[model samples]
Target: MKGFIEDTNYSIGLLDDTATPRDVIDNYIYEHTLMGKNAFFVADLGKIVKKHFKWKNIMGRVNPFYTVRCNSSPAVLEILAALSMGFACANKNEMSLVYDLGIPMENAVYTNPCKQASQIKHAAKIGVNLMTCDSETELKKIARNHFNAKLLLHIATEGISGEEDMNMTFGTTLKNCRHLLECAKELSVEVVGVKFHVSSSNNPQTYIHALSDARCVFDMAEELGFKMNILDIGGISENEAQLEELYQAVSPLLDVYFPEGSGTRIIAEPGSFYVSSAFTLAVNVMAKNVIEHDQHLPSAGKQISNKPAFIYCMNEGVYGSFARKLSEKLNTAPEVHKKYKDDEPLFASSLLGPSYDELDVIVEHCLLPELEVGDWVVFENMGCGSLNEQSPFADFEKPSLYNFMSFSDWYEIQDTGNTSESLMKSLCVPCFHLGEDQFCTV
Candidate 1:
């Protein structure tokens, strides 16, 4: 792992034991041509493992079902599977992917309330009976396709009150909970639990409120003769501080509502919190153009206060791995790997992707040092909702993913005089080809 990566043709590897992240990026750039490609410096599976352990330490009572929709890298999934993490799937393909990894269907929950008929049938055929439904239409669909499926009623919580709120699109309201339970009873669909999401950016109060609503639904379901055994506290925060706040607010309420020995199972579907910081995307600066105010028509006649702007066209953009910027409204800033002079001043720059569409622009205005054509701009926290959104637009090949570990059992054995043979036998690098386009190295 310290020298050249042996298995792949890409000969990039760590320069030394103390190799910095920039050193790894520089080494890769030295080995390969970035002609028209982006790269992902995936922080090894150990980061994910650490995150999982931390989550378990903090929220020990709550079971985490890793959301596969966040980052479905086969290597990521394999590492999580090896650690025995349950999966929260959104569709048939995700279910199949998890099943292909040898994960039992019992450890998975179909969280999507709105599912296709074919997907329902497929889940039933494969014995994945744990699913969710929010409306009568969805419940009817589930009853028709898989009546024996254990169901969770997705209740719409009062999400964050802002333009970014997405509560209206999914989940059943508290007012409709009884009606939904009655419909499930009439259709013979077993309602086993209640699930609710406070959206991505809601405060801890949102979780508390959602939990209170779920408790009401639970009592109602029990009254209706439905065994309410599961309580799904859906995904909310991406950082430990926020999650701790949520736990502090919801833990006590859980005791009051679905208490210990109450025969209720507590689970959560955390996506970005697990893998968001474990990946870094490095985009090559393909071309650059300095734009003076006088050169542009819009600012030609006006007296601009700032310096001349630089436009950098990179290989990947909003249409590619940066789709989260446009889709999830993420604000991405660039980190230049090259060093700058002490006296050199930074200029406002606009970063554009390799696409012809105007919406492909990544960063609108950010002060950066004047960069060369081959320089690299790195973006951290790229593991969320990327990769899977990548497309072959403009005939550009997808970026090659290189996974490197910072900690491993092999490191401890190095001090004990273990031979390379023994190290190779013990080391597990979970690399596999997911498809013709995706290649992962762990």
Candidate 2:
């Protein structure tokens, strides 16, 4: 038997002939038209973030901290504040992002253990109040630079970072932590609790093991006669399904170790899990031009087993918002769900984005529905996906929604022409929904 996706178009079941996947993208996303360029109302990166927050998956029993590095879009930051989700900032800039948005330092946790004087000073000034330390050196640095500062111990993942490894570098060994505790005891510094990341995989068991490790660390701190106020279970790839699994495995661990009134609170830092999969990255395949070539098999070009190289290009690249290289497994592969024409192949594995830079491409390889020139190819990397936190992509990025087909009325202008220079020149790029059916450009 074929898998559901392996079946004919009937598997997805189209409505009218015009209800193509492009149409679905049009319906879900808002778009604005520039004079020459069509500014597809790409995404309200904000709305998506908020919706994901309402998911309440953190069980809220655990203090949920938003990892800013995921999509630091001011749009996302603003919404997160409104939702009252605490922030897990990595550095001074990330902390500033939330502060500028008026989120009090009380709602934020500084997770990055190493920092410059400026970061230390900023944390003090804003009174973010909470931070992390891996070694006696970091604790000394924090204790010396500012007033009484509160911090979580940044424990290293098991076997994760090799020797010279931060595991030892970041968080002092159980033995060394006793030293730090002794020092903290003398200096009047505060060591709130322990934090660790099971980021190696989206596995629920990783979380179970991480919590167990944190428990052991907690016992070590207590043995040294130091009391912990909180336990940062670090973070995990928490989807609804994975979250449930985590809840099952972790809820019991918390019961055995933390015991509600036992004086320790569970905290989770989730960025990708909160925002990934909430929104999509839709781009036009600008063109689907093909280079005809004969098979270059070991047998040579003779007796051609010819194939069309279905190369594609998009405006977004590694520099744009695509992290195709980082997410070797979770990379956003483009698929042709519904096509504008039936003559087109029903499905295909298409590589997208202009490959001028290293893997600037969206999906190195994918199974798409079909293709054509000017066809708006939608990739699943935008909005919120774990891949965005990898590298260069963590920099300023913009993921947009182009309504080429279905939700027709969501545009400031109904018609788009190739004459425009800016896709969303009228308002900006992504507009806001003004009425039930229409939207105003940004």
Candidate 3:
């Protein structure tokens, strides 16, 4: 094991300072073929830290609790944890993961409104009391199971015009907010805050309307004799520009309704905005085929044009890390990395996953230079809501993941000499194998 480790270490040290992420990925693929059945992931931990700082600088008034459901890779968790970011967990497992990393329970918010009875009990037993509830039934369950729990009443918001809406499934309606608060008061449950999600839409009005709804809830909670001190503005952006828009729209409202020094702690649960651009996936091309479409002109009685389309099948598919395409309507395009002849014309092409299901197709009708088997196709913006949702299908194993960060960043985290070294130890680059079947940490 020592020799093998040393060999891997030597290989990594050989990389030049000018190496691009693609260079690291290409080298890793060439070295660890694993029978040509591996998919590689390059995570930029420094980028995640930079994003956290950027968020803090822009929305300094709002603390961020990273949604763990998006890219729950250990590397992602470690980086966020090192930054002292709180967590927004949807289930027991996510909470446990955070706890296992030695993060305090107070730093985690159980965001699922509808939870199992056992889950609520377990959270209480583990000292995680900050939870969200949207219904009277959930309030009753919490009251019976853990009366000391700190609660957030989740309010439903209007659907944004041009974005994915989540108002249908979760959130309590405004008409029912008063009644829910009354029930919480009667049960002696501590309803300390209001929470709402704008569903990652670009509409700035969604935040305005949602904030207005949250203010109404706050007013009702105050009337019900509860001290409302926390406001959870849920994730509502896909990029920094949209996040700034949301912040700009809601900043004035927060000032008006919940002024500074009012002791109202404002926090947000941003998942995609933090991790969407921090990961790059490199999938190996396993097979290829060319289909020629011939057009025959009736007057000429001969085929005048032959349009050949190339189809390249890779080892990872929709059932694996690319599942977001099917589940979340993600439209991802592939960038082919191959040495092309200047005269070689680009052709229409399709990329497919190595699955029997026809729905495993990744991208269709895209133009790319000619590629052969064993080549590589790279996809960016793959860090959000991926990897953790993957499954091994048709007896095919999941791809192995390799996390990366700049050497300077790794050394700084080490030099800071914080107790978080235990977590940072696992995030050190040069590959942490995160296959579905096996887990390895550096």
Give the candidate number with the greatest TM-score.
3
Per residue, candidate 3 scores C-alpha lDDT tens digits across 1-442 of: 1112101121122122555566656656665465554676666666786787789888869999999888677667777887788999999888887887788888999988789889888889888899999888888889989867999999888875655554768888998999988888788889899998876555778788888888898888888799999999887575787778778888999899888878899999988878888788888888998777342112234332455667888888888878888866664568776667777776667788888578987875566788888888889888887677555675565555665666666665555454365554443334433231222333
Kindly report which residue pairs in candidate 3 clash with one another.
none
Candidate 2's C-alpha runs over 4 A off are 1-34, 38-41, 44-60, 159-170, 202-206, 220-227, 292-307, 327-330, 335-338, 341-343, 346-352, 367-372, 385-442
Tens digits of per-residue lDDT for model 2 on 1-442? 0011111111111123333443445554333222222213233333344444445644647767888887665444544554567899888878887787666787788888677777888889988888888877777788877675887877666553334433444555544666677777787787778887765454665566566777777787677666787888676563567776677777887888889889787788877766665446655555464544342222222332344445566645555455534555543556453445656432223454454565565554433444665556556645553223322533323433322212332221223222122222322323323232233232
TM-score of 2: 0.72
**Best of the candidates, lDDT:** 3
For candidate 3, give the lDDT.
0.75
Could you tell me which 10 consecutive residues in candidate 1 have the lowest summed lDDT?
4-13
State the lDDT of candidate 1 residue by residue for 32-120, as single tens digits. 44233445454444567678778988886898889999888765676677667788999988898788776678889998877999999
Q: Would you list the rank order by TM-score, best first?
A: 3, 1, 2
Relative to the unseen true structure, what is the C-alpha lDDT of residue 402 in candidate 2, on a scale of 0 to 100? Answer: 28
TM-score of each predicted structure versus truth: 0.84, 0.72, 0.87
